[model samples]
Structures are given as C-alpha cells and as structure tokens.
Target chain A: MLARTSLRELRHRPLRTALALTGVAVATAMLVDMLMLGGGIQRSFEELLRSRGYELRLSPRGTLPFDTEATISGYAELRDALASVPEVAGVAPVLAYSISVETTDSPDEPQTSLRALALGIDPREQGLLRLLEGELPGSGEVLLDRRTIEETPLSVGDTVDLRVAGGLDVAARSGRARVSGIAEFVFSAREDRPIALPLEDLQSFSEMGDVVSFAMVRLTDGSEPDRVRADITARIDRVEVTTLTGIVTEANERLSYFRQLALILGSVSLVVTALLVGTIMAVSISERLGTIAALRAIGIPRMRILRALTAESLALCALAGLAGLGLGVVVAGVLEDILSDFPGLPQAVDFFVMRPSTLLLAYLLLLLVGAGAGLVPAWRATGLEVASLLHAEEP
Target chain B: MSPAGPARDTRGVIVVATDVTRDYRMSGSIVRALRGVSLSIPEGDFLAITGPSGSGKSTLLHLLGGVDVPTAGNVRFLDRDLGSMSVEARASLRLREVGLVFQRFHLLPMLTALENVELPLAAVGLGPGERRARAEERLVRVDLGDRLDHRPGELSGGQRQRVAIARALANDPAIVLADEPTGELDRSTSRSVLDLFRRLNDDGTTIVVATHDLELAEGARRRLEVVDGRVEA
Candidate 1:
C-alpha cells in the first residue's frame, strides 16, 4: 500500500517529482564520488608504501628537510655495519630524486616531473626485480620506472638524455645506456610519471659517487620490529634509522588531508540533499492536504500516515541514490585523465567499489535524511481536523 | 467474522455522546464548532443528522466516529467512555469497531473498487484472499460486484459512494458514521446509495448519516437537526 501510494503521488505531479529527484541525485552523486575518491587514494598510497619491503622508515636525527635528498652514503658505512645486528636480515640502499620525462620532441609539450627512486643494490640478494622484459641492470645499465616505461619515449637500448642535479653541484649529460628492463614498485607514491636508473649511473650524473639515498631494512623476525627499531636507534648516531612502519604512518597522515577535504565536501552535499528532500516533502504534503484529510476521515490511523509518507520519501531517496551512484561512476571515469596529473591522488576512483563499512554508513545517513524529511508532514497530516476539512468548501 | 460472533457485548446502547463540544482555534481565535451537543443512539438503529453548512452536523459525525476528540465532553461506546481512552486506544476502537464514510466518497484514488473496500480490513490484519472475498461480497451487496476492478476515477460519483459504503462495512463495524454520503450525487444516484444504506441497516449495522437533505433525514429511524451548534426539535 505504501509503495502504491508513493507511485500514485509521484505520478500525479511528474514534473515536480522529476525535479526533486534530480536534485537528490546530483547531491548524492557528488557525495559518493568524494567518498570513493578518498577511499581509493588512501588505498593506492598504502599499496605504494607497502611495496618498498620495509616495516618502518628511519629518518636522520630530526626531520629531513623538504625536497632535500636523504642520502644513505652519509651513513653507508653504518648501514653495512647493521649486518651484525641479529634482528636485521637484509638491507637495500635506495636513492630518491625528481627528474623530467620528455614525452614529445616539441619542447613546447608539457614536461612531466617524474619521481625516480634509484636503488643501489646487488640484485642477487632478495631480488627486487620482477622484470617485465630484459634482465636487471649489471653495472652501467639503467631500468625505466614502471609508470613512464612506455610513455617516456625510451625503448630498450635507447640512448637516454639525462640532467641530474642536487642543490649546488649538478651536471647535464646524455649517455647511451641500455634500458635493462621495466619494473613496478608496489606503491606508485609518485604521480603517473616515474623513472628508475642504476644507482651508480645516477651517482655519476649527479657528481656524487658511492652515496646511496636510504636503506630499506627487512627484518628476519617480523614479531620483533619494535624491539629491532629501538636497538637500531640505540646503536646508530648522526643518521636517523627508521623502520618501514614509521613511513607508512607518515604517509597515512599525508593522505588524510586530501581525503578529509573530499569528506567535507561530501558532507556539505549531503546537507544540501537533506534540504532538497525536506522541501520536496513539505511541498508535497501541503499540496496533498485534501487527500491526507480524506484518509484520516476514513479511519486511517496517524501511524499509517507517518509510515506512508516516510515510505514515499525513502523510496524517492533510494532511487536518487541509485541514479547518483551511476553518475558518480561516470564522473570518476571522466575525471581519471585530468586527475592523473595530481601527484598524491590516485588517477581514478574505484567506481562501484564501496567498502561494506562505508556503504553501511551512507545507508544510515540516507535513511535518517528520508525519515526527517517525512516527519513534519506526517505530523501535520495526523494533527489535521477531519471535520473542518470535509465540511469546508473545496478550493 | 460475523457481527453475531461471540466477541461483541450487545446488551447496551451502542453510542452515547454526553455534552460533546468540539472547539477550534481559527487565526488565534477560539471558535466552538459543537457546543454541548449530547445524544444517545441505540443498537441496530439508523440515525440521520441534518443541519445547515455551519451548524456542526459534520462535527457531530466526526465525534461519533471517534475521528476527533471533543473539547470538553465525552462520548461513550457500549458503556466505555471514549474520552478516557488514549489516542492509540481510540484508533484501535475505530479500526476494530467504528467505520467512517466521507462526502466526496473519500475513496483512495490509487485503489480499485475492491481494493478500496478491502482497505479497512487491512487494519484487522485480514489476509489478501479473505479481504478480497469479503470485499467482493460487500460490493455485490452494494450492486457494484461487476465494477470491482474500476478505480474511483472510472466510476461515477454514485458508484464511488457505493464502493465507499462497501469499504465502511468491510470490518463489520458495529457503527458506520457517514458525513454527507449523498451530497455529491444526483437525485436518482442519491436514492440508490440511500437504499443501499437502508438495506445495510436492515441487515443490523447501526448507521449514522450526516446530511442536509430532508429526504435522507426522513428515511432514518431517528433524526436530529442542529442550528448554531444546538440540537433543534
């Protein structure tokens, strides 16, 4: 009966119902997109960070200055010294840098900034190279980063142009280096653009030899990460020693700001949706005054009045939510290209990929909004005077 | 369930309105719609209330049906004081006992003739098959069995009223209160609906018809006329 009544009411004023439904759809779509984007970006960031094969990240003494490379060469002897530490199994030295990948010969084409992390390691130990093609670089050969492998306009055995710099000492040099292979790190912490080169080659180009960036330490015993971390800090000096877990925590903090912005906008959109639903219900109840009065006069209980109206509101919102979900998917698809340029966010949101917890939260929010919208109108219908309504001349 | 079923206590008067007054606040000014109107209706009797538009006849019907609360006085049904009952109790009593038919038919536009008739039975938790069978029987009683699937819009005013009447008796209520049941019909249609009411009354359903039509008032077993919210002899 409630469904039937809602259908009748919706059919009675097609234009008004369509307009109200559209309003709800737009608001709901914006909120869904925001929420999905937040979730996807956070997941992408976590995935990127986890791929580095460390439980925690250790930074030097205080905070590492922004944009300044944290070199392992500064403490290279110290990293080699950690082999005696019983908790530590293997350590890989990593170099992080930013370089531009030229996709077009027309220098006018936008230069894409690539985040390159060059690792100086003996590939024979805990082999990190899940090579898509050629073998890992021997001494001088360089591997291209996964994201820019195809788009970097560099193929195997290509003579790549390079300009490496750090603070004051920098060199511009091009070399006929072999593109050994293309490999992907778990966390695409960088933007869509990524490039990787041999650590020795990068050191020579930047005029800093025998220096590595950071050491990624893998623990032999997973259960003792905290104890291992405290022992490492006690043993080390000047240079900061970090476990992989610390980097993940910092990365999560960095990701929360973007996610929070999306959430706030989503919340604002939901508020607008609630107002739209309330206004539509208020107008509907006022227009259907005679019908409500008729129902009351015919012995329909006040509770039924509340139930019917609430059912109508909820049905409308559910339909709108469905439409909004579709719109959100479309929005995510369309914006993926534009958002690829954003350094910290994922290129595309996970459309239709709602987590159970998030969906449950959204469901509860929509239900409350629907019930609140229907309450005042239902109350008004129940409180109406049936006698006056029946006897009064019809307008 | 039959009205003769063992549940009903049929020894006392069915309806008793004692000093019932309905007050309304219009534009912040209190206006008394019914001023100290009192009446007693016996079981199995057909009663008609007649009055001018503003003379409180509709108010009397609403009060009798337990659709609205009286401002100062009380209404008793089978010796149970309706005024003392909570809102939920009054609603239950109306659902399980009293039936109401309004002028303009008050048939839900979305419901077909049979579905409209089955509406009150929904309150009593009747199954769909039982409700349909009972609704069909009542519609046949009102001479509308063939038009069961027709919505109120497709039916004529008189047919709609007949459907409303069928709905009123769906729960086999002891008292059926009707407000201007024939006001929207032609003379012939009005007579037909009134005839159906007469037959239903003969079948032992106590009915209260509120109307301004003299002919309708005359057909009832007892008649009361109101003027300026007071009963007129």
Candidate 2:
C-alpha cells in the first residue's frame, strides 16, 4: 500500500518529479564519465604496445622508450648477437630522427617546409606499419604517415626533399626519395608527423651507420619475456631491456593522477546528487505535512510512513539511473572524439571507454545516494506532532 | 511495563481522563490548551463536547483518542495508563481500539475514496482482499458507495467528510472521536453527517463528538461545555 501511494503521489506531481529526476540523471552521467576516463587511455596504450607482436624493447640505459637523440652505438654487433639467441624469433632495429621536408612543387617557399619524424626500418620486416594505400617503401622510396600526407598535399609517386636535423654528435644530412605509400604507425605520438624509409638508405644519408635508437624484439612462441629480458641484460651492457608488460605497468603508474582526478570529480557529483534529491524531498514533505499529521493521528506507524517516502525516492532514482547510462555513453563518445585530436595524445588512445561492471556499480551507488537523501525528510515527517497539527489552522 | 494488548476488557469504561492539563510552549509563553479537565466515556455511549474557539474541546477529544498525552495528569484507555505508554504503543492501541475524524476531511488528495478509507486497514497489516472488502463496507455505511472511485478533489465537502469517517471506521475500533466533522459543510450536509453518526451510535459503536454547533450538541445523549480549557456543568 505504501508503495502504491508513493507512486500515485509522484505521478500527480509530474513537474517536480521531472526536475528531481533530471538532477539525479545528470549526476549519474558525470559519475559514469569519470569511471570511463579512469582507465580508457591506459588500456588503449597497452593495446598499441602489443599490436606489433614485439615482446621486448631495447633502448639506451636510463632513458624512456622513444626519447629523442638517445641512440645505441654498435647496434650491428648487438643485432647479430640477439639474433643468435635461441629464444629470439626476429630483431628489428629502428632509427628515430626529426627532419624538415619541403614540397617539390614549392621548393623555396617557407610554408612548404614541414617538420616530421623520420623512422628508419628494414623493408623486409613484416608486421610493422599498416599500409592504407600504395606499397611499403623499397630501397629508394619513403612511406609517409597519413597525417603528414594530409598536411602537405603529398601523395604516392611524389618526390620530396628531406633535411635531417642535427643531433648530439651527428651531422646533418639531406636526400630526396619517391613517396611509395601512406600508412599509420601505432606508436606515433599525436603531434608526430612520421615518414618511413629503408634502414640502410637512411643510415647512409644521415652518416649514422651502425647506430639505431631502439630495437623491437619478437620472441619465439612460448618464450617468457621476463626470462628473455633477464638473459639479454646479462649478455649486454650499456642498454636497458624491458618487456612490453613492464612498459605498460610503468605507464599505468604514471597515469595515477588521472584516476585521482576522476575520484575527486566523482565525489563531487555524488554530493550534488544527494543535495539535489534531499532538497526536493524536504520541500515535498513540508508541503504534505498536514496529510502526514492526519495519517499519524489515524494510527499509522512512523516507520511505515518512512518506508513509503523512501520507496518514492528509489523509484525516481531507478529511472534516472537508466536515463543517465544512455546520456553518459553519448557524453563519453563526444569527449573521446574531442580529446582524440588533442595535440600530443596518441591517435590510438581513446580518452573515454565504457566497462559494463563499472557502470553497474555507478548505478547502484546512485540508488544508495537516493535512499540516503530521503532520510532527512522521512525523519521530519515522523517527528510531526499529530494532535497539535490536526487542530491547528492550515498554513 | 505490562503488555497492554489493545485493552479488550475496560470494565465498562472505554476512556477515562483525570485532571488532564496540556501546555504548549509557543515562542516564549506557556499557553495551556487544557487545564484540570476530567471526563469519562463509557462503552456504547454517545457524548458531545461543545465549546467556543480556543476552548480546548479538540484537545480533550485528542486525549480521549490516545493521540496525545496529558502534560499534568493521566488518560486511561481501556484501563491502561496512556501517559506511561510509548508513542508506538499508543499508536498500536489506537489502531486496534480508537478512530479519529478531523474537521478538514484529511483524505489523501491523490487517492480514491476507497483507497483513502483503506489506509488504516493497511496500517493494521490487513490482507489486500480483506482491506478492500472492509473499506468498501465502511464506505457503503457512510453512504459513499456510489463515489468509491472519486478523488477528494472531485468530491463535495460532505462526501469528503464521509470518506474520512469511513476511513476512521476501517479497523472496527471501539470508539470514534470526531472534531468538528461538519465545520466545513453547509447546514443540510452537516445534519446528514450527524444523522450518519447517530446511526453508527445506534449500531453500538461509541461516538464522541466535539463541536461548537448547538444542534449537534443537542442530538447527543450526554453534553458538556468547555470554557478557558475547563469543563463546566
């Protein structure tokens, strides 16, 4: 009976009920978005690391995975030695260098000179760059990342002039190569305009032979990356060897600040939800004081009355939770689109992703908040002086 | 405290008040709503309490119904001291043995006439089918059988008061306490309500009414007047 009565009352007051529901829904949406953003980017980054089947990364000691100007000297000997290992399936060396490229049609124009990252990789290696158009770069050809091609009006079969930027202990070099393909690199940073060419060609042009920035190692099936990393560390000196899992774990530790921000924002949303529902319920209970007093005089227990009031709040929260889930999905999608274009965020990393369990937990939390908010008004109703109120004039 | 379960055996007296005084602390002053007033209502008796405005007649009615406790004295319902009982205990007793009707009808505005009448029955943990049957019977007794589905807003003042009266009788209490039940109706409608009360009294349900209407007071078997919170001969 109490449940039925509460539903009837809520139905009769559509405008007030709608306002309260909208407040709860908006709060729920905010909470859902915060949960989604807490781990979305980290998950995307981990997936990118594993896409190329590379289990181990070899970089300069005391440097990050792709730090600029950090190169490994005597890379030819290291590559041969790593290939000789029984657990190693393949070893691919990469030279990362920034260069200035100019369109051939506008040779001397200042606007035609674009800064780009030049990646030197062996063309014979498989499972590296994903080709979208044309073929992979051969001996005298280069592959430009999609963004670089879009920015410069360059397409397959076009020739462009390149000038390497001077780095520590390395002189500047320049060359021209035919554009052989357009591709997307999974590891490219948001602002990086990348182009790939044959490793030997880039090494000869840049006068940096037998040196590379990093080596991506793919191990044989059933090989443990940790054991391989330990073996490599024991064999090699002046180099840091890390498995893909280790890199991802380190990245997640660094992204703990995002989780903390999400916590703070999520807490704020819950507080807002409580206040919104509480205020509305308080006002509604005040307006119905006379009826409540009448019920008390007619011998209704205070606990029963409280249960009815809480039932009303639960109904409203359940509806709001469903609406908020849909709204959160839309909001998260829009945020993902907007943040994908951020200047330095990786293209493969999404800023918002939905996990069903997290969303379900958020909905349950909102329902609990709704029940808690109803308590203030329920207490007030139970405290009414039935005898005095029944005789008093209506206010 | 002894277990006072609904007080079925009251030794022929359903309600008794001894030197009851009720004080109200309003702003800073202590305004005594009832002072040194005493009364006894026997089973199956039709009693009327008449007084002018602010005369504390409603306060005495509330005391008789066990809805309020006296500040300086004691009220006994079915030989059990109400002053010593917990609020929940008094509520339980009221649910089993007392009915209350207010001047403003007090019917839930959102519920139908039948649903409003079923409120008390539901409070007493009656089954849905039994509550519906009993509520319907009481509404029929109040001559609201044709208006079962009408909300309070759609009903006339007299009809709304009839619904309130039906709700008061939902639990089949030993006594019904009404405070100016006809104050909001016209003279004709008021007489019709009084006739319904007289009929219920004839059927052996004890009736206690507090009113300023002389006609209502004259129709009761026993009448008392109140002035300055004191009952007079």
Candidate 3:
C-alpha cells in the first residue's frame, strides 16, 4: 500500500519526476561513454597486432616499431641467434623509413612528392602484408598499399622513384623499384600509406648496410610468446622484445590520461545526479509531511515508509538508466564516426566500443547513486514526530 | 480537583490518566497545555470533551490515543503504561487497539477512499485480499461503498469525514478517538455523523469526541468541558 501510494504521488507530479529522471539519465550516459572509450581503443589496437602471424617483436631499446631513423646495428647476429632457438619458426627482418615517392611516368608534369612509409622485408618470408593482386615484391620490386594506389597515381607494374629523407649525419639516398603488387598492411599509420621492398635491396640503396628497424618473430605451433620473449631478451643486449599483449599494455598506460579525465567527468555527473535527485525528493517529502505524519499516527513503521520512498527513487533511476544506455550508444556512435577520420589512428580501429560487462557496471553504479540520493529524504521522513507533525498546520 | 461526572463502571475502565501535565516551549516561553489534568474513560462509553480553541482538548486526546506522552504524570491504556513505552511500541499499540480521526481529514490525497481505509490494515500486516474485503465492509457501513474509488479531493466535506471515520474503524479498534470529526460539515451532515457515532457506540465500540459544538457534546453519555487547561462541571 505504501509503495502504491508513492507511485501514485510520483505519477501525479509528472514534471518533477521528469526533471529528476533527466538528470539521472544524462549522468548515466556520461559514465557509459567513458567506459566505452576506455576499452575500445585498447581492444582495437590488440586486434591489429594479432592480425599478423608474428608472436614477438624485437626493436632497438627505447624505440617503438617503425620509429623514425631507429635501426639495430647487429641485425644478422640477432637474426641468427633468434632462429637458433628451438621454438623459433622464422624471423622476418624489416627496415622501415619515411621516404618521398615520385612517379617517373609523368616526370614532365611538375614532380609531385608524396611522403610514404617504406617497409623492407624478405619476399620469401610471407610476412605481414596480405597480397590482393600480383606476386610478392622481389629484389628490384615493390608492393604498394592499396591506399597508396588510390591516393596517388602509383599502381602495380609502375616504376616509382623513392628518395629517403635525410637525417642527422646521414645524406639523402634515392632508388627506383618496380611496383609488383598491391596489398594491405594493418600497421599503416593513418597519415602515411605503406610501400614494401626487398630488405637487401633497401639496405644497399639506402647505404645502411646490415641495419634493420625491427624483426618480426613467428613462433612454432604451441610456443608461448612470453617464454620466447624472455629468452630472446636474455640472449640479446641493447634490444627490446615485446609481444602483442605488452604493446597493448604500454599503449593503455600512455592513454591513462583519457581514463583519468573520464573518471573526473563521470564523478561530476554522479554528483549532479545525486544533488538533483536529492533536492527533488526533499521537496516532495516536505510537501507530503502531513500525509506521512498521518500514516505514522495510524501505526505505519518508519522502515516501511523509508522503503516505499526508496523504491520510488529506484524505479525512476532504473528507467533513466535504460534510456541512458540508448543515449550512450548514440553518443558513442557519433564519437566513433568523428574519430575514424582522425589522423594517426588506423581505419580498422574503433574509437568507442561497448562491452556487455562495462554496460552492466555502469547500470549498477546508477542504481547505487539513485538509492543513495533517496536516503537523506527517506531518513527525514522517518524522523518526523507523528504527534507534533499531525498537530502542525499543513505547509 | 476532579470534575463531577456520571457513575463510573470500574470493571469497564479502558483509559486512565494520573496528574498529567504537558508543557510546551514556544519562542522561549513556557506554555502548559495540560496542567495536572486527569480523566478516565470506560469501555463502550460515548464521551465528549468540549472546549474552546487552545483549551488543550486535542492535547489530552493525543495523550489518550498514545500519539503523545505527557511531560509529567502517566497515562495508561488497557492497563499498559503509554509513557513507559517506546515510540515504536506506542505506534504498535495504536495499530492494534486505538483508532484516530483528525479534524482536517488527513487522508492521503493520492489514494482512493478504499485505499485510505486499507492503509491502517496494511500497517497491521494484513494480506491485500483480506485488507480489501475488510475495507469494503467498513466503507459500506459508512454509506460510502459507492464512492470507494474516489479520491479525497473528489469527495464532499461530510463524505471525506465519513471516509476518515471508516478508516479509523478498519482495524476494529477497541476505542475510536475523534478530534472535531464533524467540525467542517454542515448541520445535516454533522447530525448524520453524530447519528453514525451513536449507532457505533450502541453496538459496543468506545467513542471519544473532542468538539466545541453543543449539539455534538449533548449527545455523549458523559460530557466534560475544559477551560484554561482544566476540566469544569
């Protein structure tokens, strides 16, 4: 009966109830958006790393994969030592550098220089790139990323002139290779398209003999990447060995700022929800003090009254939480669309992804906030002196 | 000093008050609402307490109904000391034994007349079906069976008072305490309420009314007039 009374009261005061629900829903939506952003980027990066068959990456110490001008000096010795391990299936050496590509077919037209990420790999290794047309690149051949083909006049069977960007203490190097195939590579940074060539030829043309940026380690079936990474780190010096999990952990650590900002904003939203709900409940309870006092005089227990009031708040919050979930999805979808066009983020990576567990936790948080917001008013209602309040005039 | 009253029946005494003095602190001044006043109400008695405004008639009724405790002295209902009981315990006692009707008809504005009557039954832990049946019977007795679904705002002043009276009797309480139950009704409506009370008293339910109306007071089997916080002959 108390619950029914409470529901009836809420139904009668539609404007106040709607205001409280809107506050709760807006706060819940903010929290849901934060949860989506926190997990989406990490999951997308992990998927990108796992797409290649490589289990471990070896890069120069203090350098990331494809870091500009970063090269390991003893690549041959490192490769031989890694291949000697029992669990090692194959090792693909890579030399990645930023270079300008110009079309030789249209030299008379003002030469257009487009910057591209050039990757040096072994043709026989069947490495990271997924070929869509023609064969893999040979000694004097190149494989252009599909994006590169679409962005520029470059295509399969075209010979392009490439010039390596000059760095400190190293002069600019130039070379030409036939575009033998068009393919897709997951690691292509959003700002630059990728083009692949033979590692030996790239080394000879760039005058960086026996120097490579990183090595991709393909493990045998049933081999654990952690154990292999640890062994390689023990065998090699001045080198860093990492698995996909390690890279993701590092990336998430760097992105902790986003999580912190979300926490602050989400906390503010919760406080706003609590204050809004609490104020409305306080006003409603004050208005009904006479009725509550009458109920008390007629022998209704304080706890039962409190339960009815809290149940009303919980009902409002539950409705708001469901609405917030839909609102959050729409907001996340907008964020995803906006971020997909952002530079340096791969097209395959999602900016906001909703996981079931994350959404469940968000709902639970809203429930707690709702109950907590109602507690102050419920306590006040219970503490009213039945005799005094009954005698007191209605407010 | 005790006021002269009709012959008392010792075996049927249901409420007793001894030297009750209720004081209030208002704006730094001491106001004694009930100063050394005492009374006894017997079972099945229709008693009227008549007084002008601020004569402490309502305060005495509150004390007798276990809604408030006196600042000094003791009040007992059915041989149980109300002053010695906790607030919750007094509430429980009221739920089981005492019914109250307020002057203002403090029915929940959102609930129907039937639901308002069922509220007290729910407090006593009755199941929904049983509460509904009992509430319907009480509303019928009050001639409000057809108006069971109407809210307090939709009912006339007299009808609202009848609903309040019906709600007071929902638990079959041992005693019903009404404070000016007909104060807001017209003459005909007030007479009807008085007739209903007389009929309930004849049916063996103890009824106490606090009012300033001479007609309502004259109908009681015993009457006490209060002035300046003291009862007079």
True contacts kept of each: 0.38, 0.68, 0.71
lDDT of 3 by residue, A1-395 (tens): 78888878788999888887787888889889987876678787788778778888889987777654679987788878987899999988889867788888574556556888778898777466889998899988889888888877766898889887678987888878899999887666566678888988888877878988988889999999999889888888778888878888988887677677777877887787788778888888888888888878877778888888888877888988999888998998998887777777667778677889989988998889888888789888778777778778421
Judge candidate 3 at residue A394 and give its lDDT: 25
Q: Across residues A130-208, which tens digit of lDDT does each residue of candidate 1 receive?
A: 5676667766666676666756556666544444444455555444456677765443444544445666666665566
- Candidate numbers, best lDDT first, in rank order: 2, 3, 1
Give the per-residue lDDT digits (tens) of candidate 2, residues B1-233.
Answer: 11213437647889899999999888999999999998888999999999888889998898888899999999988888999999988888887788888888888887899999888888877778988999999999999999999999999999999999999888888899999988888999999988999999999899999998788888898999999899996
How well does model 3 score by local distance difference test?
0.84
Question: Candidate 1, A199: how far from true, in Å?
Answer: 3.2
Q: Which ten residues in a row have the lowest lDDT in candidate 1 chain A?
A: A344-353
Order candidates by DockQ, high to low. Answer: 2, 3, 1
Candidate 2 lDDT over A1-395, as tens digits, reads: 76678878888899999988898899999999998888777887888778889899889987756765879989889988898788999888888777788777665543477888788897776445789999989988999998887777788998888887677976777788899999988777678888899887777777877788888899999999999999998888778999999988998998878888888998998899889888888888887888888888888899998999888888888898899888988999988887777776568777787888879988999999989998888887778788777766431
**What is the model-wide C-alpha lDDT for candidate 2?**
0.86
> What's the TM-score of every candidate structure?
0.88, 0.88, 0.89
Clashes of each: 14, 0, 0
Where model 2 places Cα greater than 4 Å from the true spot, the runs are: A50-55, A80-92, A100-115, A122-128, A131-141, A147-182, A218-231, A243-246, A391-395, B1-7
Using Cα atoms, each model's DockQ against the true complex is 0.52, 0.61, 0.58
